[model samples]
Target: MNSPTMHLPHDDHDCGWYGALPSPAPAKRLSGQQQADYAVIGAGFAGLAAARRLAEQKPGARIVLIDAQRVGYGASGRNSGFVIDLPHKMALEHPDPAHKQRLLGLNRAAIDQLQGLVQQHQIDCQWSHAGKYQGAVGPRGLAYLEHFERLMTELGEPFRSVEGDELANVIGTRHYSRAVYTPGCYLMQPAALVRGLADSLPKNVELLEQSPILGLKRDSKGQWLLQGSDGQVRTPSLLLGTSIFTQEFGYLRSRLLPVMTFASWTRPLSQAEMVAIGIQPDWGLTPADHAGTTVRMTQDNRLIIRNTYKHVPRYGKSVNEATREEIRAGHRKALLARYPQLAGVPFTHTWGGVYAISRNFTNFFGELETGVYATACDNGVGAAWGTISGALLADLAVGAESRHLQDIQAVTGMPSRNPPEPLLGLGVRTRIRMAAWNSRSEL
Candidate 1:
């Protein structure tokens, strides 16, 4: 391990997100004064990647990485584990065909980088080499996926285009009218990977768990000292990979909306159950019928289903019982709607986690005061992107520039001040209402 930073407060007592994944080893508590060249906040994918890269780049550079709770306790460990190469708003309204072409090119490269990292790290989180369905449940969804696939292939990526009953054969569902298959992506055990990455660190690096920085100060020497109730750490540079928790960095309380994305897992479906569901290919499923609802199967055979636009305070009574029921019902509807035969499966476990929502509903990054940087607003895709962001942001912290630095910087002007309580409340209510209206479930 590298140098250890102080710990923040503990998160609620939910560890099920790890989903029987092997537990990462415990990190030591912060004690006394520690000095480092780099201090990374939040030990999820972003922080971990930063820590590892810093170790590789500046060997023997004192680095202290801190987590508010245990590492991966946040969105990183709780993700649905979809390794996507697509950008947030990858299909922006940009009119320039060349810009669109270039974006497609970058997406291809991003996917390659993501897959390679999984392989290079020897991460054992059930890597599936098969293609996934970007199928549409209706005409519009199908058209969107088809257009996306067309552009991808046009940009030199591989995709299999299909429609009608043929689409059902590829996905395990009759719900979709059309679909395109791409072999490059996968369905993974997300929390397992997060834990694995944390455990694989060399002894030279130190991970401090349960360390939350309560405040900060600037020394006369121009360095920043992050202070916690238990201890204080002095580092000249720092990285904020806290996701929506970036509010801790200041001015992000409104800019980054913390949307809850809840997931439910059924008892591992028996062979009969799986067959009844028409899930032949084991490829991860995305709604070709629509753009939202992300559903997939874990390697262990459990169905992992999630829907977005849910929220509650960081810890507020399990999103209320009514909301929980809706998510659960929605998943069952998804299962039955897709595989009409598998209509009544029962869920064994139900839980939810938060996703950061920037104004554009994608990832955005920029400075939060001098010397402190925030790399958050992960929209919904936080697995590989969070890891890559952490790596690139670490480079930025060390004064090394990245080709992506400009594109992301352009989006993260100043963190928007959060709207008023009433307006923010209205936004949340609107999202819930819109989701309920579209879903097959009774709102």
Candidate 2:
């Protein structure tokens, strides 16, 4: 199942999410052909979550969920594990306000659902609801924080801006001059959660790993066809939860584009180290100003720092050291600039993953050709968005119509330019350059 294209360092994902056990691969190389009532592609969070919900709604639905790689691989396994209610993101095209509000509400609801699932499923993925801090580390960023604080207060949300000692206690950084702490966000171990969810699925729902979906088509009766390797599955309905992998599966490849985000996690820090480094806020998350680094402490005492890599993506799969250094340096600089006290802390692991960003920021959740559907493009914030997106998708598929899904459906139906591969490359480059200047264009 190995490929010449696999990156050596990328294997670090196995250590955290897939656990010590060798997780199942995708559908045994898709041998020959198969049949089902429902075929869900990509066994990560979106697909798995949708499959679980579907089984609950339609008992014995004959669902077959497939993944290109093993379960918990891709962004689900490689993320920084912070479940920020509102993650770092920007929109390519704005959807309706009502839809935006619904998405926001769904996002808030998912935070609670994720916590409940982790517990109900008995997943050992350390979960904490210590809340989150969205603030500024310098005057340049302070204005942004002030705007958020004002907006929250105007909305009648109980948020208070802090400075001086309060700011120091929250972030352990003397560099930050302002802050807005929101109580509700949580931190999670993404990989562990993925495995636990997959392991806890009901017997009726089949989970297949290493099943790279090579093609999507229809049979003589017009049912959905998910073909991969040597196996083919004909299902009455199919959900493409492949997210960033859409580019590899037929028309979907160009239908959605990929955006890369980077993360670095330090080796588990001791209590003393945690306190010394100002990560002592038991269940806290941090989102500094725009173009700023996001930091959060995991249940294991590891400080997980993540940030958007200024786009300007190069073609192909190569990860250049020069670009890596540049991106990593940007992250480290942002971190040190915020927490000057932790400048010397060593990062044991650094990684990146593709975020499937569609032109409209909204993904294709409704029926695509025939029974096939897709739920992806959380922009760059899929942790919470994935849960919300999947739940909404499940509702839509089940005929349980809601304003939330309707809003998103309308947005996707709007005219969209998929931007050919050549244009996508250029747009991303322009994004990165504008990103250097801290414009809102790259969000």
Candidate 3:
């Protein structure tokens, strides 16, 4: 087979999480020739963690972390910033108690590491242990909430059930009929957190933004040769945190499904508007149903509404103006349905992000070939899972062992193969549409 060239991430629209922040310093693009003991691609949570861990483990070695765009301008910065500590409903209800425990352990470990970094570096991303609320609108959503409650009880996890006036008092929204509050999740400004992570890298690690690898091949010495537009990097070991884009690098082509989800953020509300809604302290809520919307009142007093999914197999390169407008319309409708009082409040920014999911909902981690490693297919919880997986990938590469590494390995697996293209696209679209329709009330 011929060497595979990379198809880089295109910035279709501005990410609100990134745009809301002050402009960053000019990006340091790759130039001339470069050599590193280790090269990590994709500057998201996974890549950042992997590169940092490698530098920490091998303090005297050179490590390079490269990104196609500015750090945090891609999916990592575009996510709905929830650092979840517990498994989601599906994993929580797994038949094997040990499997559930391992997942929980991995997630919490990710959070703990991030917390230490935030404090040590004094990164001001508004990191908060604000917990999370799962809200329900109608019967279907309520049923999901009930199931979640049962799982929490079975696991002896502490949670509170709130409804009626209590629910409204908590989130300042009456759209949800009931909610379950779990006090383990943390919320933050994703873009800021990711950028901080990149900036705070150890002295031995070099961060090169806007330096997409245009082509890749193996050299006579069995080292990876990465060709950028303006330069080349030769490294003995290469790590990929590129997520679905890993397919373009000649790996995981048939095992990962790339899906795009959209989000919109409102301009900061005026003090009067805040009073009008009887706003409480900042909070975040996810729908009980998988297809339902995610809502957040940020610490900065802006509202975010994220929902709707599309099977953009082209990895968002084909997302046209029509689809963008349609998603914005959906966001507007959802916002009004929940807060009719805030009608006419305009959305300051709207954008879409792509995430990869495996057929069996497992992550892809470990070595792809000699001197090459990857962690991808995060299945929607990349913030926490991606961080720990990246760190452990470095540990695995260095032949290090620990309880955290073992836990991540136990839960990680090779992504199951997806159906061929046309069939895969059809199946995914059908399932997503049916799910959205079923959860229409929650949306």
lDDT of 1 at 22: 57
Give residue 6's lDDT in candidate 1 (0 to 100).
21
Q: List clashing residue pairs in candidate 3.
A: none
Q: Write the per-residue lDDT of candidate 2 for residues 339-419, one digit (tens) a residue.
A: 676667877666677666666555566665556667866666677877767766777777877766665575444224567
Tens digits of per-residue lDDT, candidate 3, 1-443, equal 12244456875666889998889999888889899999999999999999999999999999999999999999998888899988876788789888888998898989999999999998888899999999999999999999998899888889999898988876777888899999999999999999999889999999999988887789999889998999999998999999988988888888988888899999998888888897765788999998999999898889999999988777767688898999999999999998898887999999889889888888888999999999999888889988999999999988899999888888888899988878998999999999998889889
Off by over 4 Å in 3: 1-6
Can you write out model 1's per-residue Cα lDDT over 1-443, one digit (the tens) per residue?
A: 11133222323334355646555556686778999878888788778877887777788788888877776666676767677665433444344555554444444444565456668878777766666766566555656676676567555666776766676554556556656777767666777777677777645567888777777778999888888768889988878888776664554666777677677776677878766656653557665433356667766667766665555545334377687777678767666665566455677766777767666554556556778876787666676567767776777777767666544454434445567788887877686767656643211
Q: What are the runs in model 1 whose C-alpha is more than 4 Å off?
A: 1-17, 88-92, 96-114, 146-158, 164-166, 275-277, 289-291, 313-318, 340-345, 402-418, 439-443
Worst ten-residue run, lDDT, model 1? Answer: 1-10
Residue 337 local lDDT, model 1: 61
lDDT of 2: 0.64
Using lDDT as the measure, name the better of candidate 1 and candidate 3.
3
